[model samples]
Target: MTSPNAAQVPTIKSALKFFKVTSYITGIFLILIMVLWAIRLIWSADVWIGGPDGLIALAQFSVDPSTGEKVGLPGPQIPNDFTTVSLIIHGWLYVAYLFGDFRLWTLLRWSFLRFLVIALGGVIPFLSFFTERYYSKVAEADLKKVA
Candidate 1:
């Protein structure tokens, strides 16, 4: 008769696949958020205002007709929609990553501390790539031994 453990091989394989995919996705989102954050920080001071001519004009000093001196008023800056969207997307993806982490952690019967470490992979930029690689190898080896 086949051993009971043999029946679990497929399940473990599927879980491994799921965890790997989620790790890559979460890592990608983390990178995207970092890029967006950088862009927002660099260009945050540039402002656009409604010009006297009824057109949008970048906030800059204009020569006064009489005084022959540069003078300009600060205008309302446009919102950074891209940064906002990036934050929202990353937040949701992290949640999904957590779910994936929980699944693989439970399946592997790892300790709670290990689970927390895997979850951190989603938050720390570039860490997910290494974590995923390490965990993938470890899980595969463990599963092979079980099989």
Candidate 2:
């Protein structure tokens, strides 16, 4: 509160808006990543690029024709980059979320621990949304005090 930059109300408000948007987008992507992780666990984690049924998730095993028995290995298919693409996209989005977080944290001159907690919001499912709401209220109150 005693920081020299504390008087920069407009900058803080803009930072708050940026942080809010990043939190929401990162939260949604986090949920999507969680969903993809679950899907991988339930079926096969591997996705194929160019098989007879291109761009598909392979099962854990294949069936034997002659013996009419289940085989332990999966059928061959070209590995697709689609599975990892979403993960990469999320990673980059989280970085953007971090940038917004850092900007807000710097403007408010908050503690390092608080900054870390806010950073965690992007990784934990639904936590970003909660943190966004909580901080929006806190920032609004703080801005009012400054006014």
Where in model 2 is the C-alpha error above 4 Å?
1-7, 45-79
Candidate 1 pairs with clashing backbones: none
- Give all TM-scores, in the order shown: 0.70, 0.75
Model 1 Cα shift for residue 47 (angstroms): 14
lDDT of each: 0.70, 0.75
The best candidate by TM-score is: 2
Can you give the lDDT of residue 39 in candidate 1? 47
TM-score of 2: 0.75
Clashing pairs in 2: none
lDDT of 2 by residue, 31-133 (tens): 8888767766677454444545554645454457999654543443233434566677789889999999898777777788878988999999999998899
The regions of model 1 sitting more than 4 angstroms off are: 1-4, 45-80
